[model samples]
Target chain A: ELKVEQNPLFLSMQEGKNYTIYCNYSTTSDRLYWYRQDPGKSLESLFVLLSNGAVKQEGRLMASLDTKARLSTLHITAAVHDLSATYFCAVVYAGNMLTFGGGTRLMVKP
Target chain B: NAGVTQTPKFRILKIGQSMTLQCTQDMNHNYMYWYRQDPGMGLKLIYYSVGAGITDKGEVPNGYNVSRSTTEDFPLRLELAAPSQTSVYFCASSPQGLTETQYFGPGTRLLVL
Candidate 1:
């Protein structure tokens, strides 16, 4: 059983600020993914970090993985209202199966 | 390509009731998965299928069943509904390669009373 822990489960930040959400896993797997979900909506894939030093950025969001430490991160830059959603990090368990972390609810206020 | 689609966007059922949640994807993905998301919690994998006629249980599978009969469709059956099963259900699919970038369906909100 893989245990995944995320910090600061609820984040309230102002627009134009920056913050990072951390995901720590209990296993040795290089496949880590980030996803975002709006209220009452399905999840949308953000980034897939496949290597220890892999970093991917889209729009104002960036995700990185440090497989050696079993950790991954999702960073928000210049936060906007549209980024107010729950973000989750998941690691592949086996053969395309994934185990997800407790999401971080982000609220960006102007 | 419609990506992934699920039927019955919302449903309310009583205890011991049964229903089958339908999922289909036009991407012709080889791997399809079923997940349930409770309020304020991460999505938990209920079941997954690698290909037609192949299926496996995931992290949480009790009281849920799934089948894959074609490359595009995977249906999950709930035989005995319980309050614990009340949650939003999502269906996702991914290619067989290494990336495993999953595309998700809108979701089905089920409430067991």
Candidate 2:
């Protein structure tokens, strides 16, 4: 069974602060993805890290993948209230299927 | 373009009942998937289809079933629903591309009491 673990399941940070969410998986796959979900909403794709040391960023969110260590990180820079949502890191399981982490619920206070 | 659409935004049923969630996409995607989302748990893949008439199971595919008879339509069927089956279901599709990023539907909230 492939397990995906994420750190700091619940994060409460003030606006303008920075934080990084860690995702570690137990597998040999190289593909990783990040997704965001607001309350009662579907997932919104954030980033797709394709290879070792692959990094992608958008706005204040940046994601990186380390295939050698089977880990990935989602870094939030100078967060804002609009960035408050649950974030999940998923790794490619058998072939093209995805196995997701538990999720990091971020609450940014203004 | 109605990228991805799911019908019956919400439904509630008792145990032992059955329901089928409808999902369709207009982006000419060749791959489609069915997933379930619990409260704090992230999306869990239930079933996926590589193309028309081809289907496969995922991490969690015990209680649910799926069919892909057409390129644009993939429907998930829940038989003898159990309380554990209550959750928000999402359908996604991906076109053959570099990363194959999936486009998701709004979602269907199901409650099995």
Candidate 3:
């Protein structure tokens, strides 16, 4: 079974601060995905890291994958109130199945 | 494109009652998936379909069933709803598979009493 774990399940940061959410997986998988979900809303894809050392960024969020370590990180730079949301990391295994982390809920205070 | 859509934004069902969650995609995706998100937890895959007439179980398949009769429609059926089944259900579709980004629906909030 593939297990995915994320750190700092709940984070409260002031606006303009920076933070990184770590996602660790138990199995070897090269494909990692980051998604964000607002309160009472469906998830939205943030980034897809397909290989080791793969990094993708959008706006204030960036995600990186290290396949060898079975780890992925989602970094939030200069956070804003609008960036407050629960973020999740998922590892792709067994061809088409995704195992997701518990998720990191971020609350940005203005 | 309307992307992926799910019906019944919210529903409340008593124990043992069954219901079907309807999902549709307009992007003509080959892969569709059903996932359930429990309170304060990540999503657990219930079922998935690679294409019309091809379906498979996912990580959490118990008490849930799915059918993909057409390329654009994937419906998830809950048999004998239980309190443990109360969660938000999301439907997603992807052009290819996990290698590609999956578009998600708004999700259906189901509460089993």
For lDDT, the strongest prediction is 3
Off by over 4 Å in 2: none
DockQ of each: 0.73, 0.68, 0.91
Return the clash pairs for model 3, or none: none
Badly placed stretches (over 4 Å) of model 3 are: none
Please give the distance, in angstroms, between residue B74's alpha carbon in candidate 3 and its true position after superposition: 0.2
- Candidate 1: regions farther than 4 A off: none
Which lDDT tens digits does candidate 1 get at residues A42-110? 899999888889999999999999999999989899999999999999988775678889999999999
**Candidate 2 collision pairs:** none
Reference interface contacts recovered per candidate:
0.76, 0.71, 0.85
Kindly report the interface RMSD of candidate 1, rounded to 1 decimal.
1.6
TM-score of each: 0.97, 0.97, 0.98
lDDT of 3 by residue, A1-110 (tens): 99999999999999999999999999999999999999999999989889899999899998999999888999999999999999999999999999999999999999
Q: Taking the tens digit of each residue's C-alpha lDDT, what string does model 2 give over B1-113?
A: 99999988999989999999999999999999999999889999999998999999988999889999999999999999999999999999999622768888999999999
Docking class of 2: medium
List, residue by residue over B1-113, the lDDT tens digit for candidate 1. Answer: 68999999999999999999999999988989999989889999999998999999999999999889899999999998999999999999988833768899999999999
Error of 1 at A101 (Å): 0.9
State the interface C-alpha RMSD of candidate 3: 0.4
DockQ ranking from best to worst?
Answer: 3, 1, 2
RMSD value for candidate 3: 0.8
